[model samples]
Target: MTRSAPQFLCDPVLETVQVEHGFGTRGAVAPGGTLRPNQVHGNAVARFEGGSGVDPLEADALLSRIPTQSVAVVTADCVPVLVASADGGCVAAVHAGWRGLACGVIPAAIAALSEWGFTDLRAAIGPHARACCYEVDTPVLEALEGPFGPALAEAVRPTRPGHAGLDLQRLALEALSRGGIRSDHRGSAAAMCTVCHPELFDSFRRQGDQAGRMIHWVRPIRDA
Candidate 1:
């Protein structure tokens, strides 16, 4: 197996604490075997205790209090969300495609963390296909609109006759807000569109199945 340097984008808020969180680029590799769930575009979240190796849980989100265990989600066009407790006791990674978002993945993750006794969480939204390049049809808009309402519908601006550009980051932020994460508690979106910045990130919508996946992970730094 070929390993690459740990070239990743870090959120300033997450970096301030003992939490080690990042959004990896195409070739960057994580230190240990990253715990990635088999994302099925649904709103399932898997929780982990201190352990090693991969379990390949069938879910869209992974939550853990184990500092030594890193949880991650791989994405090409979907949004990758990494969240940590205010004190770095717990962390979570979510894979939110439009369908997963529609099914309540963000809120589900928040609830899982809350159940783990975490509060005042901080989150980072990683790179993905932004509204600038994520054009979608009526069903996608409808899936979001019924649950998220008008604000979400407004984010989906009409690009062509029947297609519209959907801002996944905006929708994710809304979901976070609805989950009780204040504006200050969340980091800004990476703001780089994977579809637009092919040299930096990958985009399934742009490159189809040939597009490589990027890993976005977060873990608490274990005490020595």
Candidate 2:
């Protein structure tokens, strides 16, 4: 990693690797940046050239060419993924919940940027529900296990006896690795599961039907 400037938002959950020394507030235009939010629950990725329109995308991942600008992904329990390839000068934000993880959204984002000559991209998995509290039905576990083998099965440990809890960020990390991103290029925020740490995070699982989502995004930028 080259150790560039910071382009993280004020919300604290969001993290970035390439664009540096900047921040943004929700609904406010990013200073010298552009923003996009993920629709999530789906495996779609949208690309933006210049800082153009508002609410321009309905996808799980967003990519931008504008340096210092950013695209945002909001989530409560889902994995908020920030990605960048400074060599290619491309950045993306992804919201990969369990469904999105099973649907292969991470690889889709990698493939989307492959057209732009982007390689050796770095990825960051933000705070979300870990295996500690992400209880799930058997179908979801079976779905994950069918592709990833026993490691995923082992990671999704049984909380009680019948139900299993999942490490979603691990799932996303596995997917990223399977997608060809090396471990050296991957970054993860330690601990702080949203469901377990309510004071520090906003979790749908913890907050129930009315939880307010936290947003994460990043973009390429030219120095001002």
Candidate 3:
């Protein structure tokens, strides 16, 4: 009941309140003029309130309170996070990779939404590179230590010499928890992993820079 298309996904948490959203698969295109950020893999957030100006699209997260105007983020191997208020009055689309996670992009997006006076939030984390195929070295683990701290080991698995497989979804969920989104409000992870299911997803690790991105989107809707 949570999918809008055969390839696109939705979450019951957001669907319960009827927030318009879709987690893209491989070939879907985002609508024209959809608000998105430049995605620096940092914690910057951009806000939209039905404005005509397009300033500050340089953020990694895009939040909106306006109905109909879509907000989106693109991803291949990175996490695409969609968040909305309980009443569907506002929504956010975040692009989170490990660097963005270490920088607190998820938490930053939630904080920005809370600052806008909508704290009762719900979120859905889309597919990304899972631990099965996503390996990392010492530098990657070291960078993650600051954000994940003692909980870091919970999402890592030793693979090779000075390297390990990393689960980005777990860390993303942790970031969501730290951002104040209740445990139940953060929906379950998508079953597909970008690397493992190449037929359904685009994997940056598998296909390198030539991989096509998926456009994950969320649109604000009026509360009933």
Candidate 4:
């Protein structure tokens, strides 16, 4: 029954939300806009500053400085992270599935933005499978342990005392903390699990091939 807040990007200068959706697609919704989504089994991020047409920029994270430019990413069972500057008004969106988490995508994005001079950055982690239902195999557990660490292991404790479930959101929060993004300033993490809440989200793990995607978008809009 839970729902994610409709993520809207704003400059406070322009005052308009550029993109309407940020799900399962790869291309800008507007001219000066940019989007990238990938199926690769790792973490990566891209940045945009000016007008970028509808072209697929393959990456899991995106950042932008331009007012109307939109940087987008996609997800299914993964956590979709949306970040913004606490004082600078800049923003970035990321796709953080288990593999992406293992590859350090969220932290990498935070690090990249830090290089750009954003100190007090806020982040919001969107809907995805939780430790309550995201069970994994041995290889997945081992792989996740490398980047997610012992806490990640603990988060994925056995659901029924023998079977394990991975918490992608917890991994994301830990990644953000490791990346130096303060949690208090960060926004909300969608409580709805894509697998458990079939009515609201698209779950690759639970629904398999039948899951329909949801959008997580943010863009500065022009004032009327």
Please tell me which predicted candidate would have the highest TM-score against the true structure.
3
TM-score of each: 0.93, 0.81, 0.93, 0.78
Candidate 2 stretches greater than 4 Å from native: 1-17, 21-33, 51-56
For model 3, how does the per-residue alpha-carbon lDDT over 95-207 read when each residue is reduced to its tens digit?
Answer: 99999998888888888888999888899998888878899999999999988998899999999899999988889889888878888999855536889888788889999
Kindly provide the TM-score of model 4 when superposed on the true structure, using C-alpha atoms: 0.78
lDDT of 4 by residue, 71-175 (tens): 666667778787776543466778888788888888877887887777667677766777677888777778788876778766776655445777777778788
Measured over all alpha carbons after superposition, the RMSD of each candidate to the real structure, in angstroms, is 2.8, 6.2, 3.3, 5.8
Number of colliding residue pairs in each model: 0, 12, 0, 6
- Model 3 residue 91 CA deviation (Å) reads 0.4
Q: Assess candidate 3 and give its TM-score to the true structure.
A: 0.93
* Order of the predicted models by lDDT, top scorer first: 3, 1, 2, 4
| Error of model 4, residue 136, in angstroms | 0.7
lDDT of 2: 0.69
lDDT score of model 1? 0.85
Residue clash pairs of candidate 1: none
Considering summed lDDT, which 10 consecutive residues are worst modelled in model 2? 20-29
Local distance difference test, each candidate: 0.85, 0.69, 0.86, 0.63
What is the lDDT for 56 in model 2?
A: 42
Query: Residue-wise lDDT of candidate 1 within 31-119, one digit each (tens)?
Result: 68668888899998888886554344799999878777888999998999999988887899999999988999999999989998886
As a whole number from 0 to 100, the lDDT of residue 70 in candidate 3 is: 84
Error of 2 at 61 (Å): 0.4
Cα lDDT over the full model 3: 0.86
Q: Candidate 2: deviation at residue 32, Å?
A: 8.2
